[model samples]
Target: MPRAAIDVISVYVRKAQKQRSRLPSFRSLAALEAVVRHGNIVWAADELGVTPGAVSKQLGSLEEELEAPLFHDGHRLRPTPVAIELAQTLGVALHLLREGWDKATHGLDTGVVTITGNASLCMHWLVPRVLAMQAAAGGRAIRVTSLHTSDTWWQSTVDIAILRHRRVPVGWESQTIGTERLTLLGSPERARRAAERGIAALGGETFLAAETRHGDLDRWLAAAGVGADTERRDSVHFYVAIEAALEDMGMVVAPIALCHDLIAQKRLAAPFPACTIRGAGLAGAYNRAICSPRTAESLFRWMKREMRRCSILPAV
Candidate 1:
């Protein structure tokens, strides 16, 4: 290209870069979001701790950036259709961004990080080991809330969660903790009897069921290529059923990881080899609207490291 043509191109490129750099900052977007949310400049200004004129100037600057009017400045300065739609989405995004910033900069260094999970997990796994995790975190507190196994437990304000989900909800993040597998546990005598009698002999024994995992026995039996014609006896939770099995109540279908300590101690024995069920696993989740990035990252890292050594998680 000739010198003059190259100079013109260079000048245009610099101007474009300058314009791109001038893209609306969070301040202007915040002002716009608040304005659209409140539906009035004065109210938005009050909410943002700024004067109405300042809010209007911010909107004006934003409008210049997009080269489009955002509001119909008629009798009430009504937001246009585009403005309303943009506000609806940007409000959520900006709220999440602000929460992440706050968490990154101002997490409770000495206070508790609340976590929630299913009752079985809290009892059998996390509760026992959380104190060590807390100590590792330099005395930051760890508070756990136990939810019913069937509860849609992820839509909460907790910093972390350990639960099973078919699909995560919108505005949330998740990580796979472990893939669930089932084993039939019983007392020493019962296990030997079942093993000798081809697991079908235990059909008449009391089936200590986990209320949380309805149909778990059926699933386990089917996976082991056995028919499900067993007696129905239910326990409140997995731990309860495991305890019952330890005391020779009945054969219970349980997660292998949860039954490890008992089996190792000879408190419970596997009547049949463990079978990986088709579709069951646990995950950790947090609401993006509430959880800070720093909190989420830290908790995920802590759980990943802890679960690998403690539970039957899939290899990373």
Candidate 2:
């Protein structure tokens, strides 16, 4: 608990650790861990179920083998430089082992998938595809969480993600799930109102913006070869933008595939041609490494299957 005590333990354990020519066995490592915890031969011996004399003899052997004095401060034990490096490395490796076991035993894949995504992707595209995935998988449950912040929710320890960024970070793997083609999705009543006034009437109404970079409005207008007037624009993130549109606040660009079912149900309708984003590929993202263990492979296969079924693009 005390800072000095932590430093002492850290030093000596590292020292005892470094004395070995090769990595220590679990028994030896455990002895080292015990010594670090107890801080002395007598205490380490009692905790490790070894004689005090034996503990002292082992420590001496370790130091001799490493040819490095592990304890610092003649009055206080110190770990040699080599010992410190070994301790930190072993600590991380041990933690990784524990984490691997935890992920394996927990039936995490049989349960929810904490997928990070914006509402527009969820509502228009993923929600339906997941439902289809659930139906085919038989008995697997899927959970979709909303990501509303400009900060990446996918950066969290989520199970999977439908990201919307162009670059995947180092050490991470990504897969192209599908592309977002922009088309106008209006609430049924809103479509009727616009129809009476003519399609150009949309130019006069305050449109909902998808606020984030590469959002629906930005992608759509860019795809359509148009730009915002800049003099007047209303912007909001996916969830807010969708809610506003549902409330008939204003029309927004949506992917045709995402809104097709709603249009059939007479809840939503597309007023424009579907087109790929201007100067961009279809707008959306997916990382391959984040799936839950059980579904990771299967869902990956399903995702590929679904994307192919819906798209003409070659699998990546």
Candidate 3:
């Protein structure tokens, strides 16, 4: 358990005792926490192994005891400020208690550290270096989960997240992992033609675009000072776009981090290296309330080292 969590719990207990007010039952508090965390009574009830009615009753009991409403009545429950704060504290405390119980029953070092990130990044970057990451973790088991680009950090059950945001979100600790440098990539033969004839050589070729990166092609084109009109094909993901590019379908603008290995293997080529556009800054995020800072830092450092190894240009 973190000392901060212990202190917060102790303070809560002391305040309840001083006021001579009974602390809410553990079940009621758990219900409140789950409901607020999930933002859906049915989901919370499912998590707690109870019916929605039961969860509602628990929430009512808690509200009655405290003489205050915790959630707004709407299609979706919106937690009040107090509810959010209490739920956050309870979340940390409960997670620590669960960890303590797990350690006592299963023994220490039994936990698997889960790292989640963009699916393309996991496939092209992290998956290849997972063994090195594990070794850097001092032999601790590591699990990597790929998340869709639209998935939020709160929706994941990961120990660490490779987030696109440079700023740390509230309630989480984070470190800058890398900057994404979007580069124009294509098949070797197409790249050779472009290198010899400049950007005009690919004017007739299709532009493979990823739906997730809607404006990246235009951005890269503007950065590269190219004004030629070209046909385009859109894919749902960067990986698909890259695959299309590899098959000589079209040129795709992608993060170098995702295509660096292919480039190194001579499977793909960057025709205009100087035209790389700076993209989102990546961060490694973790809940300090539950994750050990030292462990998170170690993993973050390894991630940084690996990214640096694959990067073809300096982050600007």
Candidate 4:
């Protein structure tokens, strides 16, 4: 072989190796990001469109490259401090990447704000009144997706979220839509029965509950000065619980705003008038974005108005 040919091949190989060494594999980085974001291997696998084993392998490769442990091995998986920090930075970077992609695909402005939240809120509150979103957007469109509050993976999909909690997420802008006022709602007949038999009698009546809002009934009963029996009850979704109440299955502690339409239609009645649950409420939140401030602000305003109109709001 010619010495000049050998030299050329050697230079090309060196250049390629250097380029590869400078850049971390996106696959490994993505796996690590997903694991950190979700705080687990199974969920990270779901997010990355792969198996848990695949995610574990990627994490192992990443750890070997970085020479650090990212997660603690135990009964419950938890991210290491370094992993948490990396995840936070990655989330911001992903948001920026999304912004760039948005600009490329939809141009500088599209006026679309995607929202996600509890399914009950979506069905009972937003879905019925989505025209309000259209009106608020002027000519722009509002997209909504419903998910269980337990599912935090929606972060990647939604521009804003209407969480059933008051905690303002870190690194995000939040508007308190309002504190949800509690009310003991029931069928009109049941309300009449409670009114006639006296409100205290409801303490012994069958009640519907939700797994998530486990102690709400107890809290409301305590406030009402009644000792709840807590027997002869069934658990279901907030929407389903309301449906059962409408069917005269039992009484339920529901948000007044969510029950407004039913109350207006006379299908459901609040035996106990609306009352506030201290330190509890829903919030609308979005990532900080410079280009769509007006759009996000407009939606936030609309959310506040809706909450107020339905009496879900408490003094902020």
Specify the highest-lDDT model's number. 3
- lDDT score at residue 164, model 3, on the 0-100 scale: 77
Who wins the TM-score comparison? 3
Per-model TM-score, in order, reads 0.58, 0.52, 0.62, 0.61
Q: Model 1 over residues 133-250: C-alpha lDDT tens digits?
A: 6765566788888887667665555667777663667877888777666777788788888888885566566788876788888887787777677676787777777778878878
lDDT of 2 by residue, 96-209 (tens): 887998877654555656555667657665777777767644547677676775656656766666565556555445566655445666787787776677654555756666
Q: How much is the lDDT of residue 202 in candidate 3?
A: 59
Query: Per-model C-alpha lDDT, please?
Result: 0.72, 0.58, 0.80, 0.72
Clashing pairs in 3: none
User: Residue 99 lDDT in model 3?
Assistant: 91
- Give the worst 10-residue stretch by lDDT in candidate 2: 278-287
TM-score ranking of the models: 3, 4, 1, 2
Off by over 4 Å in 4: 1-108, 166-171, 274-279, 289-291, 312-316
RMSD of each: 16.3, 13.0, 18.0, 18.9
Distance (Å) between predicted and true CA of 257, model 3? 1.9
Clashing pairs in 1: none
- Could you tell me which 10 consecutive residues in candidate 3 have the lowest summed lDDT? 103-112
Residue 61 displacement in candidate 3 (angstroms)? 45
lDDT of 2 at 83: 52
